[model samples]
Target: MQIGVDPGSRYTGISLFTGSDAVSPKPVAEPAVVRAGVFSIEVQHRGNQIREKLTARAALRRGRRSRNLRYRQPRFDNRTRSVGWLAPSLRHRVETTMSWISRLQRWAPVAALHVERVAFDTQLLQDPEIAGRGYQQGTLHGYELREYLLEKWQRKCAYCGVSGVPLNLDHIRPRSRGGSDRASNLTLACISCNQTKGNQPVEVFLAGRPEMLARILAQVRKPLRDAAAVSSTRWALWKSLTVTGLPVHVASGGRTKYNRHRTNTPKSHTLDALHVGVVDEVTGWPVRVLVATATGRGTYTRTRTDRYGFPRLRLPRTKLHHGFQTGDLVRAVVRTGANQGTHVGRVAVRSTGRFNIRTATGLVQGIGHRYVRLLQRGDGWTYSRQPEQQPA
Candidate 1:
């Protein structure tokens, strides 16, 4: 089995599969997903939050020096950053991705790794069918513009927000009415919406709903930030992957787009991962994906501090209570209470023996520890399953 990875700033996708004709087994064999999922890395460590914290600390330090260093000599250039150093938040993306890659390698028979690199020049992308009319083919066949639109529209119909349907390339302002084939003038719509909106100007078609119409117009001009993110960390991730001792194969984002379009596969993070490197054909894939969000393995400092570095709240010295620690995956069966069903989720331990469980829906509080059984120990990730795409 080989693993393909779609590394992103916020979500890193993983897809494991065995080739169909590669001397596989009889019953348990095919070009199918062994397992696939995305790691929600932004939940625990977003760059903005880390940057804000650093800025706040710097300002606070300046204030303290103004008060206490009036009689003392001011020190400058006391700290050193090593060569090739990355900001904490940016480094977290690389570290987190490499950790999951290592974890998956240990868990499965990962023969090799395939990872998608940064975007290639538009010149590298070519479609034989649309070679002459380059701009006209962007929404469907061109890699850069098409992928940007897919991320922008979220692989859904822009008009009705309906997904899982083969969307048609739509002109927001009808081309015959004066719309240019620029990227900003384009959107996506379901077949029915496209037919219903034939020849009618967007302003007149959605005159009743000014809000959605305005939102769509505003979103058309929005830039694709995901491209910048992938570009920033692509080389870092590539260098880290080199040390794994696996035959690491790499390709450009444009190449993945080419492979995906050649096979006519729907867009998704995990599916994009599955088509990262060389592939003859994608025969089958799992409908459900296992989402493993990186939540971190609890922190050393238990105190919540204010801006001036004063302790605001102090957590318990002992993290474990009733033989269960916070962040542990547990299933609680309440016999008689408002929460009188089976609830399986991450548990937040309390000294009172009543823990709160964070379920997929929400959080359930005040459940006694006696009813809870350990399902899996928390290993810096929360595991859950979600359908790859809801059935239309």
Candidate 2:
């Protein structure tokens, strides 16, 4: 026997087919002794067993409980400070629905279950307006339901028994023609097989696997025809939660700030400053000393500002002792933002302003010249004016 079970939001439908051999019962060889004497009995118990086995197997294979599960909606809105209290009520509705399905499954052990997948973009669920409108709780989309079945059935292609690659939710009755989104009209299919099937009917596509097709259809139809109603506890809990509104929670974190600053001044320049020069195209060699001056604070050497005004320090030399030497303590300013304060660290190396510096926290590595001040004597020469390191 073949069956097709359609489970829907409002009602479920079941269809079954009796095999040719089982259409009529065969006469039993042994007759029961009765007061009425000779009596004829028609029986085909073995045929029934075969049909039951197929039916049960199909049902077990389609053991998908839910489809396309998404993240739960947060209870509190950060912008509006508004609380969402409708989740509990909607939850109650889902609970009731699930309970009803459980009852049906319990009573119809021989009936197979088929759930149609739905196609809906879940990303839209993230929008508060859309979610609040109640679209999230609707029936699972066709693709989602098919994915659910594939997952529930352990990713084994119902027809080929192949596994691993993702399966597609195929329409028993191709949707391109006129198949509605219903449980009886869907099944799991491998990607290649699904593509080959295209919009073809299930019967046409499964011609090579007639028995499997028959069994799958029979399962879909039988549950609608013979299943008894049963309730689900999970549904009850969900319904209760929906009525009380989803749990609302709010959380926050602290923010930290950073900054850097730099300037150029020389004692030779008079205080009156007859002419103030604006930074006309601040361009220089990759390795250049950025100096900053403070009125009462004396003079401070800082690294050049990056194209974005952010301090970018580069190491000038690597072999420091006699050659820019390592472990040389240098002063620099933070030119990144509002903080624009003085920050100091020791150089671990002197290579293209690239080096490692040991700080109170630990060894700060890859120290760049933009983050350090070069010690110079006169005529822009350091120590003996011998260039020891090259710019990276």
Candidate 3:
């Protein structure tokens, strides 16, 4: 069987498929393919874990430098980064994807690998008007425009100037009032402002604040300066996949979307993986898609450290305590307490006999390990829900 993979920063989609002669050649025909199963490997902490750690480390370093200003000599010139050095978090994503592929190879005879190399064309996305030679001359490209807007407006609501709230890209002129989605017409506003100004033109909504309205208009007209193109780590992943010796087939995001639409499948990472390459129409395929969440295996370090790098927790001396390990799916039956009744989720083992159960509702801490029963040993993946059964 051939395996299709769609790798993302947070999740990797995997699909096993066979029977190529089933799909009709016509685009309008009902497209179908037989698949044993499709699933995703969801990174437990996502990329934020790495980011948070880096931020904390930086803060600590800054504090140390300030305290030891005389003792610590500045060595910025001596420190140098190696070529093609990826941040630890991003490298983790590539490594994790490769690890999943290796594991899958053991279970099934993977004849080939299909992967989506690039999801979007950065140049075209940034400058829609630049075609042919204009593409070469276009200054603003990719994420720079978005970054510019965020910085230009000071990451606050244009109307209210409220900071530290969730902001969204908003249109100055309502679409209903003939507004365009161009960068010039776009601005960042807090959720409250956006909802309140819904379907209203900028002038009408900002009538009370003439000075702010003027500032907004002027800022929108001014284009952001050109910046260096930001490179993505997906290219690094592609390079690594090439050395695996397996026949790797590359596809584009456009083709994947087209195949998915023709098949009339719902939007999902796993389903997208299934539609990564050309497929012939088939019949009687199972409708259910497996939603596998990644629960990391227990790390080598058992202790949890504090911000000052002091040991705060020694965890459990034994990795497996009472036949249970951290990340194992468990069902806790608590007879009485504030957290009573049945709670089903992954459990965090403790040497002290008390465990933490992470459930769908939330984390129920301080549950005795005896009350927990192992439902499934975490194999780095958990099928918590099916696509059809997802909440509307």
Candidate 4:
């Protein structure tokens, strides 16, 4: 019998399997040849990548050929491909380990244990074959959790109670909205549901649907109860357990091995292919943007769709921005081309050699002095901030 226990501090799942009776039968009362594994683990993590490297350039490019013609190339960290540094903090790892230990102590009695391993990373995150690049920081952990959850649920969603292809592990709360990697906060959702929910709160999507919420709650509750029923002494009965290798390598190794593994580097990492979306003034819908890549150019045209797809061309608009005229009562909205959709202000009052803008809403009062822009005057506004300004 080979039994695997997937354990976490907050949650634990157990699975038991027997080899053919002819091979060996230390059969427990359960007669089924293959039994489904229960999932009851939650991996938790904290810190996140905050300030990422934008870029760094050489002080001077190839100046000119000298008599000897020697050249000095700019140097930077090849792993990150820039001169910047990555300050990886420990908010995620500590919580995950805590969850694993908590589950291991609770659910050992009923489930037979041959080898117990915590899979923190998955093939996509670690396998050089799939990921040609260097060890991406969270690749292993993300992949591992997905694989474990899929297998445990027999590739079915824990919610919706549907089984077929494995469901993706989705966050009940979106990470973008300040959710941490807590197991208690994760759930299995179908691909359709996952995409639809995207970075939004579960409650926001569920939106007062009581029946749907009940189903999802039932799936999570059952696995937890089963795991808790097992006794600790039962787990002690298992013969052997092994901790699986984490996909991410620790920083203990010297720079020699680090350099060797860091062979895969892209020719150049441009900010191209960066998807920037904006609320379209014309359509009243979110519009995809295509920004020009030429240096010192902050112009972006709307993306156009044709036979194949959007052919990486400019978005055409009748109004072109030639710097605002003096006292135009212009809306000094952030330059979309240069600022990349960051809004500065809704209305900026022209002052002595500077735009004096009042806060549009109460929220604007708290923002610091900088980053304010004049609002782009739409069809309605004749005077920028005049009391008469109203919708057409």
Best by TM-score: 1
Q: Estimate each model's TM-score.
A: 0.68, 0.25, 0.63, 0.26
> Model 1's lDDT to the true fold?
0.75
Give the least accurate 10-residue stretch of model 3, judged by summed lDDT: 223-232
Residue 353's lDDT in candidate 2:
56
Off by over 4 Å in 4: 1-144, 147-155, 217-223, 228-234, 239-392
Give the C-alpha miss distance for residue 312 in model 2, angstroms.
87
Per-residue lDDT of 1-392 in model 3, one digit per residue for the tens?
A: 77777776666677766534456678887755544443344333245566686797789688878977577766779777887677777777777777777877888777778887766444554667655556434432333345445655777888889987778889898889898877678889999989999999999998988998898898777644221111255677778878888888887565576665565666567767777766543232335655565555656666788887888978655788778888888999999988789999888887777999888778899999878888988776555555432212
| lDDT score, candidate 4, position 240 | 17
- Give the per-residue lDDT digits (tens) of candidate 4, residues 47-75: 22211211111111223333337765656
Model 1 alpha-carbon drift over 4 Å, by segment: 20-80, 119-141, 149-226, 299-313, 390-392
lDDT of each: 0.75, 0.37, 0.69, 0.35
List, residue by residue over 1-392, the lDDT tens digit for candidate 2.
Answer: 22222222222222221212222233763332111101111111122333455575557444432232554555566555344232332333343333433443444432221111121122332242454445334332233344335433445765677886677777778888899766556567788878888888878878888898887677556533211111222223334333433331111000000000011211111100100111111111112211111111111324545676456884332244334444455654556653344545455554455655544445555545565674431121111111111212
The candidate, 2 or 4, that scores higher on lDDT is 2
Across 164-220, the per-residue lDDT of candidate 1 in tens digits comes to 888888999888999877777888899999999998998898999999899898888
User: Candidate 4 has what TM-score?
Assistant: 0.26
Worst 10 residues of 2 by lDDT: 252-261
TM-score of candidate 3 versus the correct structure, residues matched by position: 0.63
How many clashing pairs per prediction, in order? 0, 67, 3, 30
